[model samples]
Structures are given as C-alpha cells and as structure tokens.
Target: MIRVHIARQFDVRAADGRRLNAEELHAEGERLMQSLLDLEQCNDDFCDSVTATDADKGTVLVELLISDETETGAFEKSRTIVRTAIHAIGGATPWEASADLGADYRPRDVQLEYV
Candidate 1:
C-alpha cells in the first residue's frame, strides 16, 4: 500500500469569463474529483479511496490511498493513473506529487526475469 499527495490551485471562471463564487468553485472541485474516481480503468489499480479538501481560495488538496493485489508495483503504476485522471478532469499535471511506501526511505535496484 502507498499514499500519494497531490495539490493544485485552479482559476475558476465561467463561460462569460466571470470568476466562480466560493460555492461554485468548491462544487467544481468536488465534481472533478468524483469524475477521476469514476474512471473504469486506466493504467493499473485505481485509487481505492480519495479525499479532496479545499485548502484555500481556488486550491484543493487531494490525497489518494492506493492498493492492489494483482500488481506488485502498484504505487508507481497508480501514480501514472492518477496523473492521467487529473488531466482528463482538466486538472494540471501533478508533477509535484509525492509518493512513498511506508515510513522507511530507501532506493533499490530492480531486476526483471523473463524466460
């Protein structure tokens, strides 16, 4: 299991180029997050649970908890899936997102064997 944190600030505007009010802006963020969770499939296991919070004016903080039984590298794969989903919802690429496994931090090399 792994956790990913993604935060983004949006410029909420309507078709008439009018800024959305606090309620409208919040609703838009909620709608976007729901859309992301509704995707059937993208890369690997989709996020099992997600939390979206209005950090501040036009800013939303999205935290995703991802887990998969089929894929060992679920963390990496899920990150890619999240990015794609965000883009689909008109969200900016989460280039600053962070993902970590548990608390220990270590770099390891991997070797794949195929026969």
Candidate 2:
C-alpha cells in the first residue's frame, strides 16, 4: 500500500469580493473531497478508502491510499491530480491575487509511505 498526505488551503471569499460563510467553506471542502473521490474511482490502482478531513484556516487534508500495483511515478501523478483540483477551485491563479502566497494554502508536507 502507498499512502500520501495532501493539504490544500482555501480562502474564505468568493469571486465577487464577498466573505464566505462557514457553510460555504464547508461546502468547498466537501466539493474537493468529492472531486478526489471521483478521481479514485476512475483509477484501478487507487484505493477505495480515501479520507478527507477539514483543517484550520479553510484548509482540507486528504489521505490517499493506493494499491502497491500502481505504476512508477505515482507520487508525481497524485501531486498533479491534487494541484490541478486546487487550481480549479481557486480560479487558476489564486496566489497572484494574494500578496502572501501561503494564504492560498498550497499543498504541502507530502508524506509518502510504502509497505
């Protein structure tokens, strides 16, 4: 099994310059989770038991477990999948809008385990 920890940061705001409410943030997290789940279902090497958890500052941490039979470069493939999803939610260039790049919660601390 291969496991990876992925984190994505979200902003509490909409495109219209309005602050997002708690409900909206929660919805976004769920939306992201569903997107990941969708990806997992489409890949035979992906594990069925993926997990998503809401984190502080409108961020979500996802736990991805893949089967050992997956091909090489699995890490890069998984990273791209998540980065693309985050960019999609953030309008392709969310970091450009914020002076502090960290505000966008770019994915970080990718811990990989193979067993």
What's the residue-level lDDT of 110 in candidate 1? 23
**Model 2: how far residue 113 lies from native, Å:** 1.8
lDDT of 2 by residue, 1-115 (tens): 4544333333444555554456765666666667667777677755543434343454455556555434346666666666555555553334345542222434445656664
Compare the candidates by TM-score and give the number of the best one: 2
Worst 10 residues of 2 by lDDT: 99-108
Q: Which residue pairs clash within candidate 1?
A: none
Q: What's the alpha carbon RMSD for model 2?
A: 5.4
Least accurate 10 contiguous residues by lDDT in model 1: 101-110
Compared with the true structure, all predictions reach lDDT values of 0.45, 0.52
TM-scores for every predicted model: 0.44, 0.56
Q: How well does model 1 score by local distance difference test?
A: 0.45
Model 2 misplaced stretches (Cα beyond 4 Å): 1-21, 49-55, 67-72, 87-105
Q: Return the TM-score for candidate 1, rounded to 2 decimals.
A: 0.44
